[model samples]
Target: MAPTTDPATTDLDRVIGFTIPGRHARGRVARLGPVLHAILSAHAYPPVIERLLAESLTLTALLGTTLKNAEGQMTLQAQTEKGIVSLMVCDYKDGELRGYVKFDAERLARLGKNPSLHALFNKGYLAITFDQVTTKERYQGIVPLDGETIAQAAESYFLQSEQIPSVVRLGVRRDAQGMLIAGGIFLQHLPEGEVGRERLHVRLDHPEWQHVEAMGATMGADELADPALPLETLVWRLFNEEPEVRLLGGTSLARGCRCDATYIQQVLTKFPETERAEMADENGVISVDCAFCSTKFPIALADFVPDAL
Candidate 1:
């Protein structure tokens, strides 16, 4: 049963996490669900690649919710030589969410049967970018892929780049029906001095923090890829016991690319006049494909002309 949403209901199918001891306190556990899965399935991807992309998508969405601003987009990108490179970007516009990914078919085919992230991407870097569309500037942080798995790499990224201690566990699996399922949980220690020291220090001393005690749950690809699991059940089974868990309300997720014909025309116009003229034929048409969604956009020579010119 899929989780349903009602404005009056306190419980809705969505990612939920909260800081303990009030607004000033730190520490949180964010969860992801259907909304994220929907966004990841926009493209037809091999099983292993799809799972990795899903995990990245969920992480990006969780971060989007945690880091709210007036108008911005959050991006998670990884550069890999295995031909399995990927990038997920989520835009937050009036609480609506949209995202997409790009992968190499040849590499995806080779890695489809292998479920190991380390095996697929022997060496790479995970990067996070926050772009405030309303403003011209953007903030980005990148870290080396230090861990063997996606979760570990992400955890390392958060700890090293953000300077916030965090544990991120992401899982993707399929069910009997072959639906894709992806879920993730993130736990972070409140920054020091943000909350009272005595209580914060005591909690940090707990055994879970001594070592990575969090375990990522195995979700059948079908379950994650499927459009049906009740969001409440998913969260309850995964993180209900964590004392600090808080439901922050759910956000809708979908697969979408912002590329269009006008953008393609703009790109082609950037080429040197000689190069542009050489590539153009008597008909003066240019065809461009979106790198992320693979959608083709065609522009006419007239469209490339500057209005001022």
Candidate 2:
């Protein structure tokens, strides 16, 4: 059944974790509101692009909270030979999140109003990278962009690369006044053995897993994306039939970017002297703008001067 939203409900922007006790199954639900608006409003992205970015952001929140440490982060990246959407990167660090997309504006404009994922990113490859502070080595998996949406592509990555039975449902739409809203849910069947196995073991035949997946399919976009619907009710609406459904916890997300003048300074110092000189305008001032958040940082040529004292 679809969850209804009340007229007076506030924007819902949080991620919640849950588990099916004894069944060894886990899931996450993400609802976006003002955070999504903040991210998408930074640029003049078309409606389709806005929706795509929203899905990526929702997926990041769902996947990021799965980390064990407070400082861990995960990044999802996609690259394609087609000029439509050349590159896209979405990252979630700790509770912070940010992302950006690179595409051929002319080509994108030619595609018209609504373009399929395949049309937008033909022959693209999706890659997921994990950066945990405690681990000496970072982990990453690469897969082809085979599905109609980003959610489906992620599901393929889990089953094919991680050998886990996973499900992801994402919904994004604009309101009557053209406000972007997005939400998503994710589920994965845990192995009977202990967590964090050295090698992944496929477990698609579990009866409980099948049942959970079936119930999850019944969730509609109206229920998942509507800010009016409380997240607690959504979880119960989907899994109330289970014998031992339990809530792990929940965390709110915001549109966060790590870019700052200090970081941009470091980036500029790395450039060769000639390159630095070339970056300057007629007035010899260097300007840097963050593609993700569109925050501009203007630096004087003297700042790059070596030992001016």
Question: Would you estimate the TM-scores of all the predictions?
Answer: 0.72, 0.91
> Which stretches in model 2 have alpha-carbon errors above 4 Å?
1-8, 194-204, 305-309
Candidate 2, residue 154: lDDT: 90
lDDT of 1 by residue, 31-59 (tens): 34445445544566666666666677667
Query: Which lDDT value does model 2 have at 59?
Result: 92
Q: Write down the TM-score for model 2.
A: 0.91
Q: Residue by residue across 1-309, what tens digits does model 2's lDDT show? A: 112333366447789899997667899999877777778778888777888888998998899888888788899998998649998889988777888888888888888687888999999888998888887568899988879889999999997878887889998866555666788999998776867754334433567778888888888888888877777788899888778888998987877899899888888998777788889998888999999999889977778757333
Clash totals for all candidate models: 17, 0
